[model samples]
Target: MSKIYVLDTNVLLQDPHSIFSFEDNEVVIPAVVLEEVDSKKRYMDEIGRNARHVSKLIDRLRETGRLHERIPLENGGVLRIELNHRSFHQLQEIFVEKTNDNRILAVAKNLSLEEQTKENGRAVILVSKDTLVRVKADALGLQAEDFLSDRVVEVDHIYTGELTLYLNTDLLNRFYEKGELSLSELANHPFYPNQFIVMKDALGTSSSAIGIVDHIGKKVKKLVFNHDHIWGIRPRNAQQSMAFELLLRDDIPLVTLIGKAGTGKTLLALAAGLLQTEDLGKFKKLLVARPIVPVGKDLGYLPGEKQEKLRPWMQPIFDNLEYLFNTKKPGELDAILAGMGSIEVEALTYIRGRSIPEQYIIIDEAQNLTKHEVKTILTRVGDRSKIVLMGDPEQIDHPYLDEYNNGLTYVLEKFKDQKIAGHIKLVKGERSGLAQLAADIL
Candidate 1:
């Protein structure tokens, strides 16, 4: 049976092509949605960029027919602008504030009633990215759904980067004897590429052998890069060990790290980058950049150069660099930074036009970015460049982002199965006991 999906403004802002996501279903766009998009199009951020993209898509669709009238789509569905929905009259009774949310609810409620009496008896659903809007729909006895096209992974089913599989002692013996074993000898199991493996005896007789398998689970490889310390830092967990392996692997150009505050996401990546570029001589330079999204109010119009204005937002990066350099005196780190012309710390604002090659790029606070911004960064990777994106989805400062829809999650979802990328989620907080307890209990 066909369904009618009414899109809310947040849905489009979250994903510009959300209109086409309901591919074969009839999509309804309330006039209020356009108004909201228009209001956001002038901002100089990801939301504004997506709003403009949505407007362009809608404008292109106008060539087929007027947006106010239902038009046939190539997918045998319809796109419509619901200007005559009757729920506006009913909403005035309860919500007299004339807010955007109230207007959207009114349209949704009226559409649900209209679709019930249609010739084909289609079901009407209000599709929103907002939790409160869905609650309002449920209160009105209407079917509602969250815009789920952006979700990275199913709840409770996220990637763990570790796998345990049972193998006979003989097989383990052969693996140890031969220094390698084919994946065909192992039993079938769901294993992601470069996933760390703990091969247990299954009889509980001895310590389990730890190893890593290729994405296809074909070849088991031992962890050989046993550095006592990475640039004077140590791996906090097994997941970080796996992340370090992935980061050092030249074949894999992409790496992602996720964790809450104080989990050492930025510290680990920066240390690895420093080791790779300055110590290992793999890359030519160490480049670090992150988006500018203040936690609270925006700091408008500072009188300074680019780096000075960005100093407040990029101080966290500087703090990590200072620790990695191990400088004792004040301004000692600045003296080192001045000498290392190869190291560049800039904002994402100026990264669009240049092509970076032979560099170790670290993008911190990636959760504040959008899917488009992330793409722009990735697309700028020239040959022999390794890029690491690290951020906590829970700490996003972008207004339109959440745990499920941030760019970091989006990259993890999109490129997880590929061989060139690796991801890890750091669960335990290593900053302090109180911080970890708060992360768990509060």
Candidate 2:
């Protein structure tokens, strides 16, 4: 049976192509939702861009037939603009305000009632990204759902980019002696190219061999980087060791680091970038950037130039650099940065439309970016350049993005199988004992 889905403004803003995802179901866009979308069409942000795209999409659909009345969709469904908004009296008592959300709820309630009165009627569902809106819809006796088209995978089930398997005690010794083990000998234990593997002794002893899968060789070879220090920063854990091997490899151009705040994701990236750029001269510059989304309340406006205004936002990057630079005085790190001149701190806004060539680009807090934004950043990479994305999915600041839908997680899932990409989910927090407690308990 066909269903009617009343889309919320957030749903439209989250995905401009959501209307066509219903698959033969009726799609209704409430007038109040359009009002809200129009209000946001001038934002100059991702939401504004999406709002305009949605309007253009709707207007283009008008060419086929009238939207106010039911029109045939390319899919087997019908699209309609719900201009007949019922009175707010039904919602006024419950919400006590004529807000856009309230009006949207009112529309869904009215549509539900009308559908109930119709014989052989379909279900009326309100799809939204706002949790409160869905809760209110449930209170008002309406079916509500979250938009799930872009969600690739759940947080807990995200790919780890590594695998551990028990092997015969002799295989570990052979791997250690010969420096590699054939994948065919593992008997169908599947592994992706560049995937990290730990072959433990079958006796469950402490003996093991750590290597990465080489698909060309049909074997898992010893890691090129083994507990080595990059720019004075060494891996503190097994996961970090795995990450370092991927980061230092010239074959893999894309690496993703997923971890919580104190997991050294950004620090390790900065270290490798510094080593590759300043020491090895592999890349021309080390460029670091992150999304500018505010965490809690906005500070309104700051008083300064672009770089000065970015100081607070980029302080985390500076802190990691300072620790690496071992800067003790107030201006020591600044002097070091000025002398090197190879490190460039930038905003994600400026990264668009520019092709960055021969640079080691590290995008931190990548979980705050959309999939489209990720594509834009990746395409900016020129020849001989490498891009590393690092973020903790749980610490996302983007309003519409979540662990499963954010750019960082999206990249991890999409590129896990690719030979040119490697990812590591850092599980240990190295900031401090207290910080680890906070990450685990708080």
Candidate 3:
């Protein structure tokens, strides 16, 4: 039997097309949700954009018939706006407040009760991205679920972009001798383009060799830039070496790096960008940008001009650049940036509608971005440009996004098969022993 799904405001704010996700079911939108969405439609962020998109979608649907009545959808589902069930008395003993959450709960509780009385009733499930709302719904004996349509993969099963293969001693010797091995010579495995591989001795020996899948997907080739130092920075770990292989290659235009705190993701990306743009002159300029999401409580409005206001958010990028430049003074790095004329650091907000050509672009803290936001950033890439997106998925600050649904993981999963894309998940922390311990235990 078809079930009934009542959506929360956060669901639509996270994804505007969630209304059609419930196939062959009845979708209910509480009137309060529309009110909340309307209030957010005027802002200038991802949430605001989603709110406007939702409003336009619902308005387009209204052309067919009244939203208060059942309107057929293209996915064999029916949608309606619930106008009644705003009575607070039903939940007055437990939840006395007249908040929007309570109003939505009241509607869901009434619908669930009404369904229980019918001879053949459909299940009423409240879908929300808010954990507290789902908890309250459960306390009131209503079925509650999370909006899970946006998740690209489960947290534990996410791709690590590296695989270990135990090979026979003869095959390993042959790979070392020839500097490359055909995929047909190895066991049948699902290997993606530019994926790192560690071939070890299967006979319980200590010998091993590292290789990466060629873009053609038919051969595993030796690392080319493993021995080169990029901008006076060297890869400290095997994964870092794999990352450098992807970053230095001109053939691969898209690279994604994911790791925990202090895993050298940002530092390595900046080093590679500086080397390619300033040293090798491979691109016209090096552009570094990041989303401006604050950690914990926000500081409200910042002071000074655009650059000054952006300093705090972009300080991490500057720190990495300072290390690469060996600068000691406070304003020395800024002077260098101004003198270079080939390097630019800015926020991602102003990147929309701009076509970036022949540049090395790095987007840090990409885990805070939504899928649509990342798509917009990627579409801005012009001819002969390379874009690197690096972030710690476990350290997201966006209220509406989680590790599995964030833009970083979304791109890693979606582009793992493409020849022009490469990904690496750094596991070892090369910053300090204390930082590694904190990352592990804390």
TM-score, each model? 0.92, 0.97, 0.98
Give the candidate order by descending TM-score.
3, 2, 1
Q: After superposition, which runs of candidate 3 have C-alpha atoms over 4 Å from their true positions?
A: none
* Candidate 2: C-alpha lDDT: 0.89
Error of 2 at 316 (Å): 0.8
Q: List the residue pairs that clash in candidate 2.
A: none
- TM-score quality measure for candidate 3: 0.98
What is candidate 2's lDDT per residue for 1-442, written digit by digit as tens?
8999999999899899999999998999999888989999999889999999999999999999988999888878899999887578678888898888888889888888887898987899999999999999999989999999879884368988888889998888888899988888865866788888878888979998788888563889999876576778888988999988888899999999998879899989999899889999999999999989898999979899999999889999999999999989998998999998999998998987899899999999999999889999999999999999999888988889888898898998998888899888899999999999999998
Counting clashing residue pairs in each candidate, in order, gives 2, 0, 0
In terms of TM-score, how similar is model 2 to the real structure?
0.97
Top TM-score: which candidate number?
3
- Rank the models by lDDT, top first: 3, 2, 1
Q: Which pairs in model 3 have colliding backbones?
A: none
Residues 1-442, model 1: lDDT tens digits: 8788999999998888777778788999988999999999998877788899999988999999988888888777889987876356877776677788888888888877776787777888999978988988888888999888777765746565667778888888887877667777776766666667768886777846667776665788787678469988898777677778777888779988888887888888888888889888999999999998888888788879877888888899999899889989998988899998778898999999889999999999999888888999999999999999988887887767878778888897788778788777777788789998887777
Deviating ranges (above 4 Å) for candidate 2: 187-189, 215-217
